[model samples]
Target: SIGNVLLLHDLVQAIPGEVVRWALLSAHYRQPLDWNQSLLDQSRKALDRLYGALHRAAGVETNGDEPPEDFLKAIEDDINTPGAMATLFALSSEIERAMTAGDHGVVARAKGELVAAGALLGVLQSNPAEWLEGEVSDALRIEVEGLLEQRALARASKDWPEADRIRDRLNALDVVVMDGPQGATWRVRT
Candidate 1:
C-alpha cells in the first residue's frame, strides 16, 4: 500500500495544475522526487518568469521557428527534462536581449522556440496574459482596471500626486502596474 502519498486533487486544490505538473517534472524520471512546499513554490516562480517573458513579447508575431537544437538534443538524450527546461530559460533570455535591442524578428523567433520547447514539456501552454493573471476574481480584476484607468488619467493630466496615490492604492491591493510605451499594464504581485 502507498504511504504518505500526496493526492493530485489535493495538490491542484492548493496550487495551479500547471505548477504541480512543473514540480513533478523538475527532476529526472529516474530520480526520487522530494516533494515539498519549497519545490512547489520554486516551480510556481519559474513558470511565472517564463510566462512573464511571453507576456512581454505578446506583441511580436512568431515566425513558426522550431525549438533550438540544444533543447531538442536535451529532450532526446534520455528525456532530460531539467536540461530542456534550462534551454527554455536560455531562450527566454535571448528574447529579453532581442527585446532590449529592439530586434522584433529575433524576439519573435525566440518566443516561438520557447513556446514550442515548453509544449514538449507540457507546460507554458496557457495564454501569457491569462497565466500571469492567475486566479484573480472578476471583481478584483474590475477594481484593479478601474484604478489603473484613473492612474492613467492622472498621469496624462500631469497630476503627479494623484497618480502616486493611485499607484500606492494598487500596491496595497497587491497589483503591480507597469508603464510601457503602449500604456500601463497591471499584474498581481506574486
Candidate 2:
C-alpha cells in the first residue's frame, strides 16, 4: 500500500501499463533492460501488430483448436519467454494466412490458442480493440490529412524538396505515410 501522505502531491510521471508490459516482455528476464521511452514506444507498436492480427481473426469460428505444440514445449522447458514470443509471431503468421483464406474455423481456433498461450506468458492482457484503436487525437488526424494533401500537391508539381519536406514533417509527428499503387495512406507510427 502506498501510505505516503505526499504521494498524490508528488505523483510520478506515468507510462501507460500496456507499454510497460510490452517493454518488459521484449527482453528475456536475465537480460538487463536499458529502459527508455523509445523502447516502450516500439514495444507498444509490436503489441499493436500482434493484436491487429488477432483483430483480423475475430468473428471466425474455432473447432477446439490448440496452441502450437512447439510453443508450449518451449515454455514448459524453462520459462523461455523469448522462445515463446518467437513462436507467437510464427503462430500469428499462420493465423494471418488463415484469415486471408477466409478460414473462419482456423482463424478462431488460432486466436483462442494464442490468447491462452499469451496468458501463460504474461502478455495480451488487454483486448485487441484497445490497442487497435490506439490513442491518436482527432486534431492530429486533421492536421495529418492537411499535410498529406499538401504533400500530394507538392508531388504533382514536381516539387521534390517540398514533398520531401512535408513527408519529413509528418515523420516528425510519428505519422507513417505509405504510398501504394491505389493511393497514399497515413498510419500513426507504430
Candidate 3:
C-alpha cells in the first residue's frame, strides 16, 4: 500500500505546487485519476496560458469583479472542477481577445473574473511573470538575454539562418522566446 502512494512532497519537488494542484483538480472529484507525466504537462501548459493572459493584461486595472455565473454554476453542480477549469480557459481567451482589441475595460473585468475563478480552483494566484519564468539564476538570465540580443540583431539583418540557429539553441536550453510588438521576450520552459 505504501508503494502505491505517490507523495505530495516528491511531486512538488519535481513540479510547481500549483501545477500539481491543477493536475489533481483537473478530473471530477468522484472519478479515478489516471495520473501520469502527460497529465502534469497538460496542466502546466494550461496554467501557463492562463498566466500568459494575466501577464498581457497586467497593465489593466481590475475592479474586484467576481467569478462569472457559469463558473459558479459549474462548481455548484456537484463541485465540477473540470467544467470550472474550462470556464477559466474560456475566460482567459476572452481576456486575450479584449487585449487585442485594445478594450482595457473588458480586459480588466475578465482578468478579475479569471483570478477569482482560479482562487476557487486553488490555482493561478502567483505573479504571472514569476510563475511563467520560474526561477532562473542571474548567470543563466544573462546568457539567455545575450543570446536574445544576438538573435534580434540577426533578425534585423535578415540573417534568417542565424536567427533560427539561435532559436534552436534557446529551445535546447528550455527557454521559449515569444515575439511581439515589443520584440522578443522569453520565459524559461516549465
Candidate 4:
C-alpha cells in the first residue's frame, strides 16, 4: 500500500470535514498526491476565498455575466483540476467586482456559474456564512454572550460608558451585537 489507511487517518484527523474534501478536490486524480497538514491548511484558505466570493455575490443581483466556458472545457478534458481551479479563481475575481459595483444581473449570473462549476468538481461549499465565521469555539461564544448580557444590564442601569465599552470589546473580536425590542442577539462579524 502507498500509505496505510490508519496512518492516513492521523493526517486527516485534525482537519475539518470540508477541508479534507477541499484537499482532495484540488488534486488531479491520477497524479501522485502529497497528503499532509499544509495541504489541508491551504485548502481552507482557498475555500475561504471561493466561499467568501459567493457570500459577497449573494447580496447583488445577477448582471448577466455568463460563467466562462473554459471551466467546462477543462473538466471535459479528463478532469483537468488545475485548469478548472484556475478558472474558478478568475471567476471569483469577476464575482467580487460585480458585487462591488452592485450590479445585480452580473452578480446573479456569476454566482450561478460559480456554484455550477464548483458542483461539477464537488467542492461547492454552499454555507459561506458558517465557513467564513472560521469556527467560533463554544467558550468564545459563551464569553461573547456574557458580554452582551452585561451590555444590556449596563444600558438598563443608564451606565452608558460601561455599555459602550462592552460593545467596543465585542467589536474587537468581530462580534456584531444587535439590540432589538425583544432583546439582544449577536453574530460573528463578517
Q: Each model's number of backbone clashes?
A: 0, 0, 0, 11
lDDT of 1 by residue, 1-190 (tens): 6687878988789788889989998999999999999998899989988987888889999978588899999889998989999998998889878877889999988998999888877899999888877779999999998998998899999999999999999999998776765577778887
Query: Which stretches in model 2 have alpha-carbon errors above 4 Å?
Result: 1-14, 62-66, 136-190
Query: lDDT per residue, candidate 2, 1-190, as tens digits?
Result: 5753523223223545656666777777778878766887787777776776766665665456466787788778676677888888877887888877777777777787887777776677776744554568889878988998998999989999999999999999987775633346656765
Cα-based RMSD of the predictions, in order?
A: 2.1, 6.4, 2.0, 6.6
Task: Mark the 10 consecutive residues where model 2 has the least summed lDDT.
Answer: 4-13
Best candidate, lDDT: 3
Q: Ten residues in a row with the worst lDDT in model 4? A: 58-67
Q: If both were scored by lDDT, which would come out higher, candidate 2 or candidate 4?
A: 4
lDDT for every model? 0.88, 0.72, 0.90, 0.75
Winning candidate number (TM-score): 1
Return the lDDT, model 3, position 166: 96
TM-scores, all models, native as reference: 0.90, 0.62, 0.89, 0.66
In model 1, pairs of residues that clash are none
Candidate 3 TM-score, C-alpha based: 0.89
lDDT of the structure predicted as candidate 2: 0.72
